[model samples]
Target: MDSATRVQESRVFPHPINVVWNHVRPADFKFWTSAVKETQVEGGLPGEVGSQRKVTFKDGTVQRYQIVELSDLAYFITYEMIESNPPIKSSAALHTIKLRKITHDNSTLVEWESDYSSSGNETASVVEDSRLKKKEALQDLAKALGSK
Candidate 1:
């Protein structure tokens, strides 16, 4: 692969920054992302950098990731997948999430972006599939936050 393809999605949540951040934490991922059936912290503190986790999906796919960056003051977090299963295989998959406080009604704007290269030859298929999955995950997040 030449380089990793990037996919980005964003949603507005009608909740305060702190409240939205609470729901966006890795510990609460399974609640908002349907693909994430379960998650177990592998090492270190939950929200701290270098923390690792094993995420099991509903389809029985498992992926391991490490927290590469985290900033509470900036409301941002990033993860690098160190291991992955088929179809979405990647040696350097990166996921970044950013939250911006929207002054109107104390809402929040959340942006999620993922960059990865497929290990298989089906790069386009993998990218499209990931896009759809992330879209659903964001919708789920909005619903979980009680946003319309």
Candidate 2:
């Protein structure tokens, strides 16, 4: 693993904070991102912290993730990528999605961020791929949130 590669994107949704929050919660992630082929419950409550999900991506890579933190008050959820079958290049990866209220029109600002480490010659390709996927995911979210 090398120094973490960070990817972040923000969007504003013309919906209530809780609405955007619920839509992007751990369990409902599949609803917004086409990169995920399927997701299965692995442990605990589907959307609660400590819960786990086995996610199969469209690229055919399978990975397991654990919900490490969830805060409705602060409107953020953090999860760690715990395992991968083909093994991720990153020794460690953490993803966080945060939301903030826009007081004026009751819209919501959602920020999706991911930090991961990759090594060797594949780092540039991997980072660029991750950035593209994140951008696509955010674009997909805008459609799912009905803001597109």
Candidate 3:
């Protein structure tokens, strides 16, 4: 038996948590160009739990994801691969984004986590890869929001 990989990362932004969550959740796939192609939501809205959405990769591979958990401004979202293939037989991926409001016109921190341990492929480095890519995304989000 092999253990799966768990990857997590967080960043502090100079903006409110709600602002960070807005870009990361509502425009999920559009959050980063390198990680996703376009997200096609089939169920409820972004903040609602139990909602289903299809995340299409730049390579055209699609992953059906469901919203398993949610909160007012702090929440966790999970994406389980309903369909499987060769490298990834099946996987349970979760992304948790927590927002902390610092002040009325000050900064906030955005904590992010992504776990892909249920994939069952210990040798695969997809989780690690995603972590690196996510760091860049955080920077992008910061830049994108700071200008607005």
Q: What is the C-alpha lDDT profile of model 3 across 43-121, one tens digit per residue? A: 8876567777777777666777677776663434445445432345325566666667777666776777766655355
Worst 10 residues of 3 by lDDT: 81-90
The whole-model C-alpha lDDT of candidate 3 against the native structure comes to 0.64
**Where does candidate 1 clash, by residue pair?**
none
Candidate number with the higher TM-score (1 or 3): 1
Model 1 residue 63 lDDT score: 82
Q: Give per-residue CA lDDT, model 1, range 47-131, as digits (tens).
A: 8789998888889988888999988899988998888764355546788989999997888998989898655566676678778
**For residues 30-85, what per-residue lDDT tens digits would candidate 2 score against the true structure?**
65467888888888988788999898988898889899998978999999999998
Provide the lowest-lDDT 10-residue window in model 2: 24-33
| Candidate 3 ranges beyond 4 A from true positions | 73-90, 103-105, 118-124
- What is the Å distance of residue 81 in model 1 from its true position? 0.7
- Give the count of colliding residue pairs in each prediction: 0, 0, 0
Q: lDDT of each structure?
A: 0.81, 0.82, 0.64
What does the lDDT read for residue 109 in candidate 1?
Answer: 90
Runs of candidate 2 exceeding 4 Å displacement:
none
Error of 3 at 114 (Å): 1.8
Per-model TM-score, in order, reads: 0.89, 0.89, 0.76
lDDT of 2 at 92: 79
